[model samples]
Target: MSTEENSGALPLPQDDPVVSAGLDIAMRWGAALGGPEKLKIAFEALEPQLKREHQLRLKQLDMQREATARAEENAREAAERMVRLAQQKRQHALRMTGLWLGAGVSFAMLVAGVYVARDMWWLSLFLWGPSLLAMAKLYTLRRSDPGDMQAVTLGMRSAANAAQQAPPPPVP
Candidate 1:
């Protein structure tokens, strides 16, 4: 047979004994078994196995896609949680700052009242009463809430009350 007929369409390496031997055996078998018809039957027999492999590969790809989607969803949830936590922290900070400012203003008013009492006693009384009442109301409102801030407000109110009851310092 011609080299082209022996090797079919592809060129066989004459230098490789193993390849040449395998090809020779295949060629002989093809001839013995009716060649093209036997090859077609062999390919048909292998089609199911090839299809199973393709299906398995598709399933693996689907699983990987689901895993990637889950990971992305988890990341999104985590980011949203972090944003909520940050917003809560900012809100707490603003609340605390407001509480501090309120307390400071009340205390300043009380101090001003005490200093002014040295001369204008009635006007000082007017300032002191309102400041004390505001402090008391603030403390009461905060005390209803359960936190360290509540305790701090209670302490501040008690100190203010104590200062209000104490005798004025002797005039210099």
Candidate 2:
């Protein structure tokens, strides 16, 4: 056999189901064979190199796992930050809307009061009717909105817990 065929196998790509399954089978075979004693002295000279390579591969996998975890944590934090930023923007806009609405309604009520005082009831209706209606609608929407941080955080926590609790697929 060519030396290339005798060389160690390539490090399997992380998270690859096929490679993982192949590795599982290989480990089972090794166990069934009752270890390298079966191969005996013919493979003895290469044992040190094999052990070194296995250790190196395990170290590499450890690094990959930690990196994957950090990447997931970063992604989760970024998503939460984005959600908070969006909520801040919505709150700011809502505050501004309320501020302007208050000012508009107060001025309209003042004008309507003046008109009522002058006995111009029809003009008073035109000034304050829509203002009151819009104010009522804004309050209603604010009450119904589900954009609070507590709600969003609860949803994210539940989803994360669900993912963590779920079992991996059968390896058969």
Candidate 3:
């Protein structure tokens, strides 16, 4: 390595701050340009553009918020409609079940009336029909209505048939 390369040396500025400031004044006086006025006009033009951009951003946010609210409202309405449809279906099923039960009860009563009339005419007329009518009225009560009376009646008939078929207990 050379000794000149190891020497601690630095370049110095050709002029001081006073000289630099004087040169700046002389150059500006020679140019005679409206520098600060042009800068002010540029800043004033940018202010309106920035304000417009900010307003547009706020409008976009508002529109998005409104769309979200509308979507939420639609979802809520759909849910309510689903609940209503389900309730309607349940009510229809209950009504159909009641109609079927009434029909079955009437059929059983008619068969019983025919059978009882052969042996006991007055008893069938005064007691059996009235008892059936009373039962029909009682069954019409909503709170007392069995949900699936057809299944229950079928179960009872099966039980009776099973009992008839079963052997009697040995004399114990």
Candidate 4:
């Protein structure tokens, strides 16, 4: 440190009644800091650590945001899957009801056709043909659709299925 630069930098406050006021206080503080150049160097030296901490905080926030978004997306997808499964179940119930009704009607007609066969053979044939077709359709229909409900985690479901399918333990 140069003697001229270091000598008498920050003057102590005088023991006078008159306050040195704003400019005087500022000059004293600036002199205590050694100069504007050293102040600049101090700030420059501290900036990298401050900047790194700021970036780290921002990265943490971004990670949290991304995780939340992924969770919401997974929830949304699960909800959609549930809705689709419910719709499919509703449609299946409706189809099964219709098919059961048709089967009942056809079976009734077949019985009626047998009673009518002895009286009017041609009329019985007319009723029998369509009844047979309806029965055939009911019997040939597939019970399950190709697109069945898929679970993300089948832990409980698989356990239940296994329990149901496994042979009962011998009564001890």
The residue pairs found clashing in candidate 1 are: none
Tell me the TM-score of each prediction against the true structure.
Answer: 0.57, 0.46, 0.55, 0.55
Candidate achieving higher lDDT, 3 or 4: 4
Top candidate by lDDT: 1
Q: What are the lDDT figures for the candidates, one per model?
A: 0.74, 0.64, 0.65, 0.67
Model 1 misplacement above 4 A? 1-34, 131-172
Clashes of 2: 0
**Tens-digit lDDT track for model 4 on 1-172?**
6433565776546565354465466556568889767767877899999999999999999999999999999999999999999999998898888778777777887888799776555546655664355454554463333222232123335545655675665566
- Residue 75: error of model 1 in Å? 0.7
Ten-residue region with minimum lDDT total, candidate 3:
122-131
For candidate 2, list the clashing residue pairs, or say none. none
> What is candidate 3's lDDT per residue for 1-172, written digit by digit as tens?
5323554865325378876687568546544645556656766889999999999999999999999999999999999999999999999898778767866786687787688665545434533444455455545544334534554455456555755665664565
The candidate, 2 or 3, that scores higher on TM-score is 3
Q: Please give, for residues 1-172, the per-residue lDDT of candidate 1 as tens digits.
A: 7747754577757999998898789778778878778978987999999999999999999999999999999999999999999999998887787688767767887888889877656546656664456554565445333444455556567656766777776788
Ten contiguous residues with the weakest lDDT in model 4: 144-153
Per-residue accuracy of model 2 over 43-153 as CA lDDT, tens digit each = 676799899999999999999999999999999999999999999999999888876776666676666657664444334443445444444445544442333445445
Ranked by lDDT, the better of candidates 2 and 3 is: 3
As for model 4, its CA RMSD to the true structure in angstroms is 20.4
